[model samples]
Target: MSVTDILRLGPVMPVLVIDAVEHAVPLARALVAGGVRVLEVTLRTPVAFDAVRAIRAAVPDAVVGVGTLTRPDDVAAARAAGAAFGVSPGAYPALLAAAAQAGLPLLPGTMTPSDVMTVRAAGYTACKLFPAAQAGGVGMLKAMHGPFPDQLFCPTGGIDAASAPGFLALPNVACVGGSWLAPKALVQAGDWPAITALAQAASALRA
Candidate 1:
């Protein structure tokens, strides 16, 4: 499916940092129960691939993806682990080309108009606004929309429930990625119920 379709599948896409592979299944199950279907398993830990595999194998309906992708190998690695998509912190020509060649629906990160231009030139109309707050937040997104209203973005970083709504309310925003629902301590402690509740609350925070 397209990136926009995946974003529209749910209001909140949990950006997970899986340190333990064993927690993948339960965590995915909880998010699904709370009405979330798309998840981004960031490649930040040694067991990241294992967690992706576990989530894919155990949760039949979860639309699992990978995040923190920096290199071409990162896209390949995530694909091998069964990720449906891959998210990068920033955009690069080789990396974007590799992702398209690897058949990974990539949401490349961008922090400026030029970055967006490059990604758009590569046939990607959707992107992620990394460090959303520091990059000037909704105002930045609005500025971008003036020139490229067709482009869709999922702003990540420094985005909590409070600021998320403003981004989502924008016409150019497809969705918003955040860590508010899957706190590190909660995930590490195996507190799926709390995470599910958090996801529910976030889902309700629609634009």
Candidate 2:
């Protein structure tokens, strides 16, 4: 699927950091149960690939992806693990090449006009505004809209339920990425029901 198609799968894409491989399927099931199917599992832990494989095998309805991709090998590994897509904190030439080579769709991150231009030059119109709050949040998106009206964004980082609506309200935003839907405490407690509730609330947000 295209990057835009993935972004359109739900109102909010949960930025998950699954520490335990065992939590992967249950967490994915919870999110899917609540109408949130686009899951981005960050490669920040040892068992991340395993978690991805588990979720892919168990949750057919969920569109599983890998995040925190920084290297060419990361792209290969994510593709091997059956990630439908990949996300990075920043766009790089090698990473872009590797993603293209692996036939993996990527939502590369951008924090400035230059960064946007770089990705745009590489033929990407959809991108992630990483560290969104620190990069001026809604105001930055507005400014970007004026120059790159055709560009679409999935603004991530420092966003929560309270502020997601404002970001979604923007004409340029296709959706948002958030970590609050699966908080560490809830995940650690194995509170799938609570996570499902959070996902339900997030899924209801409108653009």
Candidate 3:
């Protein structure tokens, strides 16, 4: 799917950090059970690629994506691991080039107007607002809509269930990225039902 189509899959895309590859499939299943199909598994752990592979192999309904992409190699690696898309914390020359070369759909992150411009020049109308709260949250997005009316954002970082509706309410926001849906305590304890409940609530945030 295109990045825009992926963002429209659900109101909240869980930003997952999987430490154990074993939990990947079940975690993906739980989220999909709650009506969330787009998942962003961050490349913060040693088993990240393995987790992505496991999810892709086991979960046909989940559109698994790789997040926290910082290197040129990560783009190729993510595509090889079966990621449907990729997200980066920031947009850079090399990473952007690598994504184009590999033909990977990317949601490059941005925090400033200049970053948005750079991403736009690279042929992306959809992007992520990294560190959303620190970047002024709703206010920043509102300000940006005037200058970048054609752009849409998936604001990640420092967002939670309580604040997600506010972000989703914005016309410029396609969705929001957060970790609250798969709390570490819940995941570590194998509490898939609770995660599913969280996902259900998050999935309702937009509609």
lDDT, candidate 2, residue 74? 97
Model 2, residue 178: distance off in Å is: 0.6
lDDT of 1 by residue, 1-207 (tens): 988889888767888887788888999999998888899999888998999898888898999999999999999999898899999999999999999999999999999999999999999999999988899999999999999999999999999888888888899998899988888899888899998898888878773
**Counting only residues 3 or more apart in sequence or on different chains, how many pairs clash (N, Cα, C under 3 Å) in candidate 2?**
0
lDDT of each: 0.90, 0.96, 0.96
**Residue range 18-126, candidate 2, lDDT tens digits:** 9999999999999999999999999899999999999999999999999999999999999999999999999989988999999999999999999999999988999
Winner by TM-score between candidate 3 and candidate 1: 3
Report the lDDT of model 2 for residue 94.
90
lDDT of 3 by residue, 1-207 (tens): 799999999999999999999899999999999999999999999999999999998999999999999999999999999899999999998999999999899999999999999999999999999999999999999999999999999999999999998999999999999999998999999999999999999999888
Off by more than 4 A, model 3? none
Quote each prediction's TM-score.
Answer: 0.97, 0.99, 0.99
The C-alpha local distance difference test score for the whole of candidate 1 amounts to 0.90
From the highest TM-score down, the ranking of the candidates is 3, 2, 1
